[model samples]
Target: MWRCKMVDLLIRILPVSAWKDRLIQWHVPGCAACSEKLAAREEAMSVLVQERELVSVKDFWPVVNRRLRSGVEREAPPSRPAWQWVSVAAGLAVVILTSLWLNRAPFEEASADLTQKLQIDYIRIGDEPARAYVFQPKGVNMTLVWIEKDGEGE
Candidate 1:
């Protein structure tokens, strides 16, 4: 299968040399697959040659040059009106100013009373027999909790 694929690729990409012709002559006759592939490739190449013959080489360059010359004469796109741009800029400025005014004080200052910030009414214990101890060490703004099951000894 790989050999068949390699021959297909070589048929298209290989240069038109005597070595390629000799290879096809020697190998294609022995393999029906190779012979079929060669016939198909030759038929395709002949079709391509026929299509190529329809386009005269002498006329190709002049047609391309004429198109390029006409392309240069095409008008440029019209510019957008100045007032539309000014109104768009004004609208964006109004949106930015409104957002800034609304978010001027995003966060309010904390209350002076510390009790209002950290309030604890009461702690509830579950049905399991356990002891809970809460500690707020001095000089630190944090609290620590410790729980001990009734049956466990430390």
Candidate 2:
């Protein structure tokens, strides 16, 4: 029952100005196209307002301080920095393990094969008492001296 100009004046003053009763009345009754146009206009206006530039950060600080003082607090969760020491330690561990593994000889390799290949006689001894046997693996003289004494258990 209010005048049409009264509704327009109210729309100009309200914050969410587009969803007024007068506009909805015409747009909802017999026109889908008009309703779509109104929705599109509202969306466009909202995007334009967001994209608009304000004054510098200096001028903006007062507004921010006012909001903060009014108990409007919003914060992001804290985050940790990248794992430098953990990564370095992991890398060092990997390097150490790789070095150890690379330096080791396999157990299944024949000692005779290595002795013959190297052309040097290296001897291995056991805990027995009779003789020092000589092994010529590829004609390299390797001796096994059996010491017949309780060297440590005596």
Candidate 3:
């Protein structure tokens, strides 16, 4: 199938002086299918060439410009208006700001409460001495014997 198409293409494109023309002519006589395909392709090409309208070079630019303008008119409107773009941006900004403003107070309160708790824990751990001596070593066994001294564990 491909050989027939290739031979048809070479016969159409190659000049008379090309050696491939003689080769194709030799092959076409032996191959009945290739000869038939080449005949059909040549007939189709001749009909197409004869039916095609030849445009003058002077009239070509006007036709091209008219078609281009018509195509532009048929297409959708180019870009959105500038004001529409600005309004969309403003809307997105307002939504983002409102969400941040609504959440600001709780976030601040949580941060302050965490700071206070951490400070209180630090103070209690540093100032309390009885919390440290609750564990005592007694002959290879650990014991929690609290001996109360005055002003201690108060």
Candidate 4:
């Protein structure tokens, strides 16, 4: 029944023991949750002990150790060559850089197209406003505005 957080947590994490009854009295109504949990825990442990009484640990370890040793493979080869992994990483980096460089043309063309279409008459304030860019659509009167700051644009 003594139920400080550190002490109660220690009881819950440990194996059940004869000292549990003393714990119940020590905590009492001040710690009902801990007491009930410990009682249920004790009951479960008693049942488990009874079941284990029918087992022979003296006759168990050799069979278990034999099974564990037998399952180990003695002939496994190394997984992969280091040079192969290095070449794969290098090739991936090159491909990414090449793709990024090649896509710049399309992006630049789209920006130019957007700039030219923005000069239409009555299109409302067609000048490139400071901190802003206007992307006007083809054959349409609509435009999208993006506000850009000192060194960043969003």
Candidate 5:
């Protein structure tokens, strides 16, 4: 019984060359179980081959062409919306305006608070009206003297 089971397993797994071995041939002829196993394996293989669908060369190109056309249509570029274009234009305008505003000098009174911080004195030297001021902070050795030439309105 053990030998019959082993022969059945070998018949299921062994290649054609192994099946043609003299020992397998002698065992398979007398053993009804192994012969039935071999017949069943052959029948199952035949049924599977018959049931499998094979693609013909004549129908292959038309199926491939249809798939390729569908893929190309799916990959076609979409149109942009009006709001998208408007938003892009608005963003570009904002960037340009911000850059221009950042580069421009600020408009403010020049000497609005300088007169209160520093002591102003006017003196005429030899015919020229000049304004002079000394900026010396407490406990500092550096003294800054600012003299304006031809003081007209400042």
Candidate 6:
């Protein structure tokens, strides 16, 4: 059986309430993968429990009721200023332009190699112009194709 399957089986076959303690004591000492997974699960469960304790219906129901009566859409204005958004947009644009400029030659060479290696023919089902894109991701065994009709009610 797979290691994960064995770990799952051990967890399921053990006691219900004390499964974590039993699994840690019995199984995790021998299996490093299971021990790491168990630690991550424990951390996630502790964080979930802490977040659950922080939330209560009584804490927000009064504010919601008051807002419903007062018809206020928001309690506070937007936290970010307009200049911050503009600067963020400017930074994003710069990053995008820099990346595209750096990768332009490599992308063009790859596209030329791909077109030379693969021949794609479009099928016309009707009078619409069709677009077909074929791509194979690195380290993947599958090629994906996307076909779409263009110029529709624009």
Q: Write the per-residue lDDT of candidate 5 for residues 14-129, one digit (tens) a residue.
A: 77865548558779778877676565766777778443465543658888889887896566554568678888999999999998777554321223234336555566666798
Give the candidate order by descending TM-score.
Answer: 4, 6, 3, 5, 1, 2
Model with the higher TM-score, candidate 1 or 6 = 6
Comparing 1 and 3 on lDDT, the stronger one: 1
Clashes of each: 0, 0, 0, 5, 0, 0
lDDT-wise, the better of 2 and 6 is: 6
**Top lDDT prediction, candidate number:** 6
lDDT at position 89, candidate 5? 97
Q: Positional deviation of 124 in candidate 6, in angstroms? A: 10
Q: So what's the TM-score on candidate 4? A: 0.31
Best by TM-score: 4
Model 2, span 31-125: residue lDDT tens: 55444445576677777745347444357788888988887486644434346666788999999999878765552245655554653234333
Which stretches of candidate 3 lie above 4 Å from their native place? 1-80, 120-154
- For candidate 6, the lDDT comes to 0.72
Model 3, position 6: C-alpha lDDT score:
81
lDDT at position 57, candidate 2: 35
* Candidate 1 clashes between residue pairs 3 or more apart in a chain or in different chains: none
The sequence of per-residue lDDT tens digits that candidate 6 reaches over residues 1-154 is 3866776877677667587567667767787776566557667787665655765645787888998888776566656787799899999999999999998878767776765577677645387667777877764444688777765436
Model 1, 28-61: lDDT tens digits are: 7888776764457667787675655666556677
Supply candidate 6's per-residue lDDT for 17. 51
Q: What TM-scores do the predictions have? A: 0.23, 0.19, 0.25, 0.31, 0.23, 0.27
Model 2 TM-score is 0.19
Which of the two candidates, 1 or 6, achieves a greater lDDT against the reference? Answer: 6
| Ordering by lDDT | 6, 5, 1, 4, 3, 2
Clashing pairs in 4: 1-23, 1-26, 1-27, 2-26, 2-27
